[model samples]
Target: MSNIVALVVIRVALDRDDQQLRRWERKIAFGYRMFIGLYALAGASTLPVAWLIARASFVSYVQSHLLYPLVLLAVVEGCVEWGLSRLRRGRHTLLIVTGVLLASIAIYFNPRLHAIESILLLPILASVFFLSPKKVWLAGILAMLAECILYWLNPFHGHESGTTPYDLITFIVELVGETVVCHGIIARGAEIWEELRKRGRLETELLVRQIVSEKDAKTDALTGLYNRKSFNEYLEFALRISAETDTPLHLAVIDIDNFKQVNDRHGHLVGDDILRRTARAIEYHLAAGDFLARYGGEEFALIIPEMSHEEAVAHVEKIREKIANIHHAELTTQHATVSIGLCTYVPGEDSQALFQRADQCLYQAKKSGKNRTIAHP
Candidate 1:
């Protein structure tokens, strides 16, 4: 009982403040249904015990013991049907009331049953599930009152001719103590659920914030491309793995043609737009194993791995031509073109040597004419 009630309380409390409470209410309903089932099963057990007792004639025992259980089972089932209907409609309190009623019936109907006083606690536990002090107190008092009434009406039910004042006091203490524990379990369950929930939310928020912070550190804010520092680290790692595994590598550096003249004639915003547009254009043509980064103010670096020499040159030419075709109305008529320098990596070549060769090709491309590519063998 404690385990079921505690689970229900914890789940409902944790999910209540979130939008998921509606879904978890079914768990609460399930807990109540379990209580109802236990009550019914306990009541039904009396039938077999009554049948086995040979003290009375079969007809007499059937009249005294068997008949009442049959009637009680019918009534309990009726109450369960009514309660469950209300439960389906989200009236959870109906099940709690039904459990209390059924448990009471189980105890009173089986008068010759031993230790009947212990059964009084079932209703109190059900009432305390609400986590309301007043509800538990009211339930405890009413239950004690009802039990006293039953004992008074049937004095032979106790161990002696009647219950003594000491027995009465002992029952009160036990009832109060057990009721307190039931209340505490539910209240404590809610507190534990709340603490765990708060910690989970804080952790999720910190994770997201950390992810965003790391991205800002590694990427260009304007172009949303990997910045120079990230590109350097990526290239260094790519080179080490390529040399170890004998994978081919090609690196290129692209500089926008007449970028300074464009910035001088237009403005920084247009320059920024051109840079972003060029990044997007390069991204569209890149293969799965390609890496592109904004290496400087007007320069972008690209690394393509596991491609043949011919495929690399053809791809770089395609990107260069795509950049040369970008038309801007704000530029008044002149189109922006990019000059690229391409080189394949030697088997054991360091990053610096490979970059130097690509940079030299960039120098050659500019020396020959502005808008073109220079490939270094």
Candidate 2:
């Protein structure tokens, strides 16, 4: 029995945690899609500028070289935007390959134009959106290395060329500086994402803990019913609402008949079983909108909203009959019964007054040969 209860509690907590995690994933995925859309748009916008520059220069070599790869990159971005899973499945390699090919073609056309090497930074920056710090670092380093090889292989190197060694040195310095800044920004974003996940998990845990605590505070540990404290608070609240709405409130105070004799004959453990069984039997007879609580030792209280005095008496009588017919194996006499006192609350009356009247009826029921219901005159 205890194991079943523990499993239920654990399942509830796990369900809450899973819900929180899914919410975070949805937010991150949304942001990632937006980033991809902007990136694709940026690439598409650059095509017009590249086209005009190539046409004015009348350099077929530059025009063909730049146009083919820019179009290919646009296609690749579309694939990535439509299916981000492709990025995780190694399709990101297509992006890196396109970037390297474009840089190599530019360098091949004008080997001495060291400024063109800055184009390599595009692939490095694109990898930052992957949210993987290691991927970003690796892409940046590989891009720099690829540029270094091209620089050494340039045909005009060491010649009296327009591009001097100082230009190459300055380009490398700027590339390294930009890579550092980009890496720091990407790493910080990853940290912030992780922190949001942690905060969500903590908040879920706190909410689950609060629910469990509130339930425990109101429940009777032994009978598995609302305890006396909960009963009092609910009764008062119901009275106030009924008064405001002009609705009738019916209250029944039930006491187990001969409960002490059962305890003396069969021991307290068996008596406890009878109490629990009797509570279950009474609860089965109640309908929706009715409140049942363990009011005291071997006693329970029921609150029926929107019921008149006659209807309330009939309801309590049914519960009394049910309890009288219940057979319990743990009871020495093989049967148990309850005496119920029924009363309808008067409008504008305090809860204490209502309870006192109910108590008086309960006393009268006990006095007049128990196991029957008594309603206030």
Candidate 3:
């Protein structure tokens, strides 16, 4: 019984956590349909047997009283079905509660209504399917109270009233049987729901971790820029776009001036700081539609799509000036500067060809002097 109760509680909790309420609605509809079908089948199977027993006992009053409450319960349950179909969360709760209370009262009042005890099954099913764990607990409390009241007001009790120990035993057995069956169904449903929810949460977490891993693979750790692999991919994409649009593209190769010297003078830590600061300055000076990547070591590459050789050179000069102006707090030595080599795309040119031209211009910049931009036609 405790295990069953725990399962029901878990199902109720899953229902609340389901962000998409359509799932909850479908569950409710299926639960109600099952209840209706099961009860209808039970009624068809037992009504005739009950009628025959009542007639043999010379108790025709049993048939009329029992039939009346069953009809009323069926009607109330139909209303609950309709309410669940059309209503949303809070409104659905109200309708279901009203239906359960009506059925409980009707069963409590009818003298021959021991047969109507099946009405309680509907609420138990609803508690599992639609209501949350908190609501299931509340419904359990209400059902217990109703049962106590009905037992106290029962008019068939007494040794002299032709009622024997067998009759009392039968009544107690029926009550316990109904309670156990209803509670068990709800509990099992809840357990299945909780297991599914746990699996769903785990799957979502795995998906998030997978996405973060992919992002990390493509990004540089130091500069927070695209790494060499991503840079290659972007360069291929840019070349394709430039070819399609028949637009001239520019490639710039930038190298920090005497980066090894900075490392030896200030320490590797300060050198790393300077690299980060220079990357930021370069990023700040770049125009929209321009992209920069950490090519390798202390070198970076820029792709300026739809720009001519002269325009690319001007942009690279601005980046060089920006790097020269960047003040690093950890730098106890001289200011940092960068040199750049710019080249323009030609028809049918591949990434290697463009990189070679840019490298040649970069070599020229280093030969002429550092802290400058050199361009190749």
Error of 3 at 120 (Å): 4.2
lDDT, candidates in the order shown: 0.75, 0.74, 0.71
The stretch of ten residues in a row with the least summed lDDT in candidate 3 is: 156-165
User: Which lDDT tens digits does candidate 3 get at residues 280-327?
Assistant: 888888888998999998999999987777777888897888788877
lDDT of 3 at 356: 91
User: How well does each candidate superpose onto the true structure, as a TM-score?
Assistant: 0.68, 0.66, 0.64
For residues 84-200, write the lDDT of model 1, one tens digit per residue: 555545333554455455555555655666676676776677665565565666667766776666666553645664556676678878878877887777688779866887676
Count of backbone collisions within predicted model 1:
0
Candidate No. with top lDDT: 1
CA shift of 166, model 2, Å: 8.3
Candidate 3: list runs displaced more than 4 Å.
Answer: 1-99, 102-120, 130-137, 147-179, 186-191, 308-311
**Per-residue C-alpha lDDT of model 2 across residues 1-377, encoded as one tens digit per residue:** 44554555567666875665445434434543454455346545656776777766645544444455445545644554455444445544444444455455545555654366777776667666656666666667777777777767777767787445786677767777877888898889889977875676566566667787899999998888999999999998999899889998988899998999999989999988998898898889897899999998998999999877788888889888988888888766778888888888987788888988988899999999998888984
lDDT score at residue 125, model 3, on the 0-100 scale: 51
Residue 52 displacement (Å), model 3: 32
* lDDT at position 134, candidate 2: 67
